[model samples]
Target: MATIKDVARVAKVSVGTVSRVLNGSSKISPESYKAVHDAARQLGYRRNAVAQALVSKTSKMFGVLVSDVGVPFFGEMVKGIEEVARQKGLHLLICNGYHDATEEKNMIEYLLSHRCQSLVVHSKGLSDEELIQYSREIPGMIVINRYIDAIKERCVFLNNHQGMHIAVSRLLDSHNGVAYIGSSEDIQDATDRYLGYQKALEDRSIEFNEQWVVHCEPVAEAGYKAIKQLAEQGELPSSIVTYNDALASGVLDYLHGEGIKIPEQVSVVGFDDIELARYLYPKLTTVRYPIREMAEFAANLSIQLLEDATPSVSDEELEFVPKLIERNSAVI
Candidate 1:
């Protein structure tokens, strides 16, 4: 209930002095700082972040936009971002856009309206032009897990094509029959991964067989059903490359139920080596997405972009490569 006026009156200092002290301005004298602190503590005064931002044109807040916070992948990403936030004495205002364009736009506007100068966005719903425009407006804005050619310097993302290609290529080393379980989601990641699968086959001079590939929802049940359909058709491939670990988990379950020995019979490779991949029956061979490291870099870069005129890495240094994690599930 206490205000700046009350603190100033009790501290016996002008309102500007109290304001400077509260705002961490170095111009304030030690005497004024001590007085303001004592008076504010006596009155149990809390600084209003919004009001302070209105005056200072910024705040100690980083706005994060993700598809869904409940998802484990995003949770780890948030953990990384929060780590950096805590180190800098900053707070996070996170919002879920649910992969909806309108919702994504709304969440972004809401963060901006709250005077969030530093923003980290994981937007799969918005167009490149829209995101590029937003990056121009918010100098501290950085895109995560997605890329835009115009704002390549502002993006921290993994190469889905390269990751899938690496997984598929690794499988091709010992197995000729490769299947793909693609995400039905209409995102660039899915498209690039699917393309990566096909490219890997082409580079090996193997004839393409569209029959072994299935596009379904990127979930465990969907992955299970996808493989079931493939099995019912005639036969499954010698090796399978999935959109993500969740799909791979389902594939493992189905294969286990069918008495198919993993690696011995059919090898499986998954993308985004999430924690779940480690605990699976035969473990999992996966591409490490490195989301945690990517997120930490993004949050740190957001701060740098806000504070420094030069920023860091003016080129395409934001791109991250995925490392293939070989576990028990895949052979050779």
Candidate 2:
């Protein structure tokens, strides 16, 4: 509960002297520095970042808005940002929106209320116009996993359409019949991925079947249910592509329960090469999303806008591409 005044009083110095020493001013005498240091240690006085920011007229915090902090995918995202924050002696103000629009807006406002000048946002609910307005208001805001041409310079996103095209094309090379388990989420990512799947098949002159596709929540349970749905409709397709690794995991479980041999009787391809993909029985064949690296790039970009000169980043640099990781889960 010790303040600057308390440190000054304990050190027998003026509050200004204490401030100078704590702020690492070269003007402070060695005796004053030692006195302040000794007094701070004795009183356990810690410098408050907020109070310091008020005097400096700049923020010492980086705010990150994510869909859910509990998700392992976002967990890696936080870690990536933390690596940058630690290097710059900055603290992170993390807030979760739980993929809700109202909550997402509230979290961004809360970060702004705390005077966070630099932000790395992963928003699924806010519209492009709303976010564009926010980008105008906050020069250091960087959007991840989404793109807006108005604020393209501040966006760090993945090429979901291209990624899905590559994945589906790979699957089609081996099998004529391919099924898709896509996300029911109303996000652009879901739409882009689905379109990518369709476009790949169309390029090969394959007929699209409504029965071969199932849209569900991007979770393991949904994956399981989607696979079960496919099974009940008639028969499971020889090759299946999923929206994400979580759903693909469920498909694997369902197939295993049915005593179906993988990559022989059936093949599964998943997106987002999450860590769990490796541990699952018969390791997953997935597309590497590189979320952590993308987050790290976004954090560095945000800091550059706030701390130093903004780096000249091109659209290609900001846009990431996914790579298909061949594993035991899939084959011809």
Candidate 3:
């Protein structure tokens, strides 16, 4: 109910002086600042964020778009972005695209309509051309988990190929029969990871078989179904590489129900070192995606691009390599 004018009257100072103190402008005297603060506290006065944004022509807010907020993967990414945004005195406006192209475009447009100057996007459905146009339109937009050559400087992504390669290589070292359980999504990540698995097989002179590969939704239930399908065909491999930790956990559950011992009869390696991976029976061995670090970097870069005329992107920050985490699930 209290306004700046009320605070000014209570403090016995001019409204301009109160404004300067509230804005933290160095031009105001300390006495005026103290008096304004004391009066504001006594009157329970709060600064208007929308009014401040209108005056500055920029909101003190950051926007983020992820595939699914309910998933732990996106949850971690959001946490990282929130951490950096809070430190910079900004709040987050989050949207979920649900891996749909139209939904992604709509969500992005909604964020822009809100006058959010800084944005971090994780898009799997939009084409490179569409994303490129968006990057040009929004100078502070940063892409995560995907690479576009036209906006290479604004992309923060992991090396999906290398991550899969390392996972497959680990399995090939000890197991003669290896299978790959991958996501059915038509995203670049799914393609790149499958290619990495194939390349690893070629490097070891192991023949590639289509039957050894299965594609399904990137979730625990789909993983369980895929493993069951493999078993029905009597083509289950001695070792398996999964698209992510959730799928891998499903595979473990299915194997346990079937009375198959992990790392004894079959070994499994997963991508994304999510927290659940460590707590699973026999602990899943996985590749660390470093999503939290990447999300924080993307949020920072988005803010920098908005504040600076020329923003710089380091190679190390743009291309993050996945690290292999050894655990009790796999052998050799």
After superposing candidate 1 on the true structure, give the runs of residues whose Cα lies further than 4 Å from its correct spot. 1-58, 314-316
Q: Estimate, for each residue in 182-239, the C-alpha lDDT of model 1 and write its tens digit.
A: 9999999999999999999999999999889999999999999999999999878789
Worst 10 contiguous positions by lDDT, candidate 1: 46-55
Worst 10 residues of 2 by lDDT: 46-55
lDDT of each: 0.89, 0.90, 0.89
| Per-residue C-alpha lDDT of model 3 across residues 1-332, encoded as one tens digit per residue | 78889999999999999988877799988889899999998996766443344468768778899999999999999999999999999889999998899999988877875667788999998889989988876778899999998889999999999999998988888989688999999899999999999999999999998887899999999999999899898857899999999999999999999999898999999999988899999999999999999999999998888778468667776999999999999995
**lDDT of model 3, residue 220:** 98
Taking the tens digit of each residue's C-alpha lDDT, what string does model 2 give over 60-157? 78899999888788998999999998898888999998778889988987787677767899999998998998887676789999999988999999
Q: Which scores higher on lDDT, 1 or 2?
A: 2
Total clashes for model 1: 0
TM-score of 2: 0.83
User: Which segments of candidate 3 are over 4 A away from where they belong?
Assistant: 1-58
